[model samples]
Target: MNNTYITSFDYQVPIDKIPIAELRQVFIDDFSDHVDDLESPKFQNITLDEIEAVSVYQNYNPGTEVISVIEKVLTDKSDGRELDLIIDYSVVSKLENGLSIGNKIQEQLNARNALVLSVGNGGCLSFMLALKTAQAFMQANDQYKNVLLFSEDHVIGNRYNPGLNVLGDGASAILLQSETDSTMQLVDVECYNMGRLNPVLGVRHDLKGNFKYKEFENKIQPLHYKVIYDLFNKVLRNNSLKIEDIDLVLYQNMSHNDYVGLKSALQLSEDQLHYGKMKGHGHVFGSDIIINMCHSTEQGKLEKAKNIVAISSGAGFSWAVSLIKN
Candidate 1:
């Protein structure tokens, strides 16, 4: 195993200051004329109460959000630090024009000496992929010092669909270094992608085809649980550990029911899970795990924890689980 650690992380939600209620009000006002459309089952039976509970941001741009997080992380924490590589995980090729967001971030951060790259398109599993890639990079090159992984998503275009889970606009930054002195160590990572299920969710016309949203929704939850259960076992077995060895588990915040379904399927107790605040943060792509980890640390929940597991599933039918030794 190569020496790799998650030294530091920070996240930013530009519209986090706004209350969920206000966000919901805006939606109500915009879609007031189509009450029937909003009431449809396709919208997940969304109500004003549900909107007020789930976190969401209306107009923030993900590209701008990503740049802000990167600037803050480098200024406040990574000052004078040199990065060997920077990876941006996003859904689109470029936020604006033809220039990649990763390249723009690299230039703005004065990381000209570092290699810049981008991967994934609205895939929540991108963060795990980024970490895995960083680990592999460190193992292949002793000179590799630090790798910056940045991810962000904003409510854009049809993403405001009333029938989908509340999507928030935010960005998160994680710094992975070759040093072993950090508090969080990357123990192991496991990822699986089921290409056949790609059309079950997301906006890609080619991937989605003529699939009925209602039919897909009915089967998606069980698939989520099954994949998570299998990945959980695979990660534990690979690390020579068991369920009892995991002190805490974090997952991508989809909705209230999502957390409950996973907990029931996995047979995990409340003490072993951390997802209560998800209703307040909604789903911010792959940043949910990092956000949960940060909150848990702030709340002193990780004080007694030795090992933590972070799991994420993307709309592209990809699932990833990573174990961290604290």
Candidate 2:
């Protein structure tokens, strides 16, 4: 396998920030028809303080959000190497420009030479999916020396995920180099289908072609710790590293309390964890990992981080974990 290094990453969100407090009623209204099930976990004990605010794109064509950040990052692309782009394919912005998700973004970038592709079922695990595929492509295709991996979310209607974190509208662009650099090197990326668990279909279309949300899962399986520990352990074992060998752990901004089981499962110290963009952006799909990574690097925290692991679980009931040596 060819070595892949991440030289830089950038993220963008709409200027508008909607306080979670103000969005409570709208969240409840989204599932009003299903709220009558008093025993359902979706309506249970959801407090406003769990999340502070989530950034959103008012116009709602999330393809623009993905394109904006990539263009901003590529403006300084002086390396002049042929570039290939990989992005989450679920933006649902076809109505905006009548193009496929990947093609719409590629056209917006206007890079005729740049190859573009999409990853399906892109939620919290999309970044890992894209990263793994991008690195593999880099190893096989010599024409491309750098790859841009991006993720953006807005569609699927209501951003709120029931009792989970509010999905924020944002996009992240990560630049990966085929050669080693003084930045982060890809150690390994592992993803599991996890299809047995329930899928988190936020909003769905009805037979009449109208919009409606499926009844939120009466309860989500609480066995994430096992899945996480097993996968992380496998990555660490394959790489000949232990939990104590990792310098930092970045998990998605699912919710404040969601980390309890994760923290316990990983056996990590409080200081070993870095929570970035949680209160500010909430969960921005798999972008949360890249966003948190950029946030940590911007705050000068990466200097203290050597080997880091990012973990996320989402929509397709997928689990993804990546280990990087910085």
Candidate 3:
């Protein structure tokens, strides 16, 4: 049950949009109507739709591309180690019909279950997908010796939303299996969702009102932090752990300000919090948390700790916290 080590990781973003930071900021600006203080009167005059149009992330399908890179990455990283099971997800926007993503992967990988966490009308589909993936992995009879947890989201094509284009599509595949043969151990997991809200914070649509994205601000939406704090507290409390018990805090890829607020709330030290290639890769949607964990290991950050916690949050207005012990 011990001696797990994350061997390697592989990542690829379309060279066309290699610099995704610019796109991300554009989307952030488009959604900036919610900013505390608006400097330009022109922004006030612009409609939300106009702003959304500018923020869209385009090109590159993270789902299919993620799988290709992940299969190659995991296999290379495993270095001939035999896997007992694999858990994977190629999540795309509901507007994009993610079911096909799963089908595409099923063609390549030998997986027992294919779960899809559709956002419905909520924006935090990533959080929901992660929650589902963790729950399924934990509940399984441990019959599978190796598990591959994968996530991918692509922005272009379906016009998921104006912000979708700004989000560079990417995928991450993690090999999870017996602690004896595994690289990283899954210690604990927690999840919380904003039960009361309509979940869809942002909604966009075509001129015909077909469907775009109904937007919601995570900052203004207390539900984002509320569920996050609640889930984190529960995970620690149930495990009889204090904030200091965590060696490192791996947060979901989020805005810098949001990260600060979370660190303050969790009382985490700067050294204790880690984010890997997040800005460089843009948020890999649902793969953010897992990718960070893998990236941390690949970069030798996790080598120092025997215990770590991974916290993730997304638009379904949800929060998830998972702990691992090395």
Candidate 4:
């Protein structure tokens, strides 16, 4: 694993609809009649201009989405080689009978010979944990040739959680190999878990079955800024790098205000951060950073960038940062 590389990656988000307005209307027409109640401030304050569009899946399950993303990656980038392991980072795992989502994905991929492992409950940071786990597996076992990391989440059952940004449906896949000629290379990774705020930002079902978005905003938002700032500093220090050395910082795709808050906290300029994906794609749970990176590379924004940092924060009170060099 001396020359481990992310050879190629691809992401899939259903684009049958455009702009957030259309999606909202579709939801309103199909689910509820009280439009004002659905658009209440307690749910979310995002405007149409702030969020251009989001992908939605009405008939696909998480396991099927995972398999679809894997097929896309293999068909478009891979060399028709079999994978050694498949690691899934789905926060909401849909279980049928007794089988888990990971097992269903493995069975669908026909990778019965490959090892399957799932990491859940880490929210947006789950994929970072999966990446770290894949690296460890490769380093520990020389026989493991390649590993695949997949992440996908959607707003199916918990659509009323207003503490979070507007939810979307999307999936991303990354292929890790021992030797490849890709420009992007994984340099270092770090993660921290602060469980003090675990219950502040998830779906709440009490007697009224109402959401606690206001409480989450009041209690967790301030802590989020501090935690992100500290994690960024820690990763920079641990890697012997400075803020100026980072060509691009790809943080999670939240609202515009959240991005501004982070930029102000870090005192970074617009050129130092890449967050244009948020307006068009919104937040896709664990796949936000990966989707941003892929789109940035495709748009040629990363051609001259030498070092990039990808960071994410999850509801479980976990933060992760990964340093990539090109």
Tens digit of per-residue lDDT, candidate 2, span 195-270: 5444334212121212122333322345567788889999999899988888888898877667765887888888
lDDT of 4 by residue, 10-104 (tens): 78887754567665555445544422255456455545357777777767755776676778777645542467888887665456562447677
Q: Tens-digit lDDT track for model 3 on 13-92?
A: 45444434343354355544333334434223322221122122255443456666667756644432344434444445
Model 1 over residues 151-236: C-alpha lDDT tens digits?
76654422233444555667788888876457788878888887777666652422212334554566675587888899999999
Residue 72 miss distance in model 1 (angstroms): 4.1
Q: What is the Cα-based lDDT of residue 165 in candidate 3?
A: 23
Error of 4 at 100 (Å): 4.3
List candidate 2 stretches off by more than 4 Å. Answer: 35-48, 78-81, 89-99, 198-220
Q: Report backbone clashes per prediction.
A: 3, 0, 32, 0
Per-candidate Cα lDDT values, in order, are 0.69, 0.68, 0.51, 0.71
Ranking by lDDT: 4, 1, 2, 3
TM-score of 4: 0.84
Better of 2 and 4 by TM-score: 2
**Better model by TM-score: candidate 1 vs candidate 4:** 4
